[model samples]
Target: MAEKEWGRLPEPPREVVLRVKRYDPERGRTWWQEYRVPTYRGMTVLDALLWVKENADPSLSMRYSCRMGVCGSCGVVVNGVPRLACQTQIAAVASRENPVVTVEPLHNHPVVRDLVTDFTAFFEKHRRIIPHIVRRDMREVEEAEYEFLMTPDEHLSIYQYSLCIMCGLCYSACPVAASDPEYLGPQALAQAYRFIVDVRDEGYDRRIAIVDTEHGCHRCHFAATCSAVCPKDVDPAAAIQRLRRIVFLRRLGLWRKRKVAPLAGPLEKPLRRIRAEYPRHNLVEGADPERQAREPVDIDFREEWLRE
Candidate 1:
């Protein structure tokens, strides 16, 4: 059989159909508009929107600045998920065959235009937490003379929670924000926990007091969706749990007060027997026999194996 020669094939251009939710202040009714764009290989959703604004329609309004994820300005609901448009690729998110991308303004906020949502309420809640390091004392000293050194473990403990960019994605996704305007939401409560857990912070009691009420930490139902959708991986759910512990401990008078109460006659008999049989030394050494055996075996094995 004779081999047939194949001709060069043309490159497949990227394209996607975007359903944008548009609203104008002048026009009270909000409507959806569809636009198809020839997408590039590495084109982002923000790029597609910008292309539509420049080439297709000039009046299309959207908010974007850095064109990167850091700015937290280009956040919009993409396919019901709160995402930063600049960071999401159209090819990755949009269906290849259908390619119908739904773009809408973030929920729980007033829509400004096509993709811009007002962040006044978001900032107001953020500012209410006083997201700044409250010093224990204002005593001034030389940098060399006075230094607060922290352990590596201590620094890393709070490092993950410190990555929040205030993007308001979690705030928009929160159900509490929709029902109650003064709920303080996840972001604010997460920030409250950041300061509350700081060992150097003296305002732990004050910060806890702010969020201990009905509209605060107590309001969280432990849905854990806030942590799941967080771009920075700041587990606001864990912070809420820690806050609960703090609140419980505070209410129980476990913070500084120690209460001495006599044990019941029946309880005291068993406890005395346990204390007499185990003793302080035996308790300190631990009750795990396997663990004790493994320690000596591990030392012998390491010495023998290395020598061999």
Candidate 2:
């Protein structure tokens, strides 16, 4: 038997009007531009937008690196809902009666162009949360001694929050973000909770201090809009609420502390000896072994500052 095509739409290619909110910086104006395009089976919003750019207007501007939903670059407001264009099928959103599909730049962001929005502030908020592992001992972290291991249950605890692609969709749909400029936003707060629950992390005090301010996780009112619009189902609203509860419980001396993951001891055997199938080369023919053995150089400023 032949393999069934899952993405195939029942109907054939049909004409649909793509209404885009276009912004021209040079003209200092924004307007709606419509284009009639043919939509085929398995066609996505991203494909439709690409068709519009290629056939209707070549001057259209947008940011999309990986055409899949993993990059989170093609996030836009479709019919007032924030979604990833690459993941949203045209047939799912459009109908026979209403053949118009409206595409606009994500809300709560400065419009860079027709469909591009500036992510400078969005990334800055994410950076404020310090979205990385933080340990109490800097020397243990820097030395290539042993790896900190977490149990299966502990890893799954923070795995959901770690799926955030920084798409800004949740931020766009957040009511608090719309009203408050200084709010850390759902994306940052969700990440704050991600590392907070990690068994290997020890920067809870520092991170909590940053997020306990006036415009921090406390500002979130549990609207749940962020969770509804998230493509990855990160449930940022729940994370924020949990974050607030953690702060409250800690203040009241009711917070329960869990044991951190233990570090691995010295290896009994060489890595290759333990795992015989481990790749010896860089997956390339005639690759230099010395160059491959060299560790990647990266700047880590967390150890430079004195503990508070």
RMSD of each: 17.3, 8.8
Which segments of candidate 1 are over 4 A away from where they belong?
1-13, 139-147, 256-308
Clash number by candidate, in order: 1, 0
- TM-score list, all predictions: 0.75, 0.84
Write the residue-wise lDDT of candidate 1 on 1-308 in tens digits: 01122132222246788899999878876999999988876778899999999999898899989997887888888888888888777765665666888999988888877788899988887787767655446341222234444566766767878888887888788887778877888888988888776654556767777888888888888887778778778888888888788788888888631221121222222221111122334455447655654544312223334456
Q: For residues 126-235, what per-residue lDDT tens digits would candidate 2 score against the true structure? A: 99988887878866678748898888898888989999999999999999889897899999999999888888888887888899988998899999999988888899
Instruction: Give residue 132's lDDT in candidate 1 (0 to 100).
Output: 65
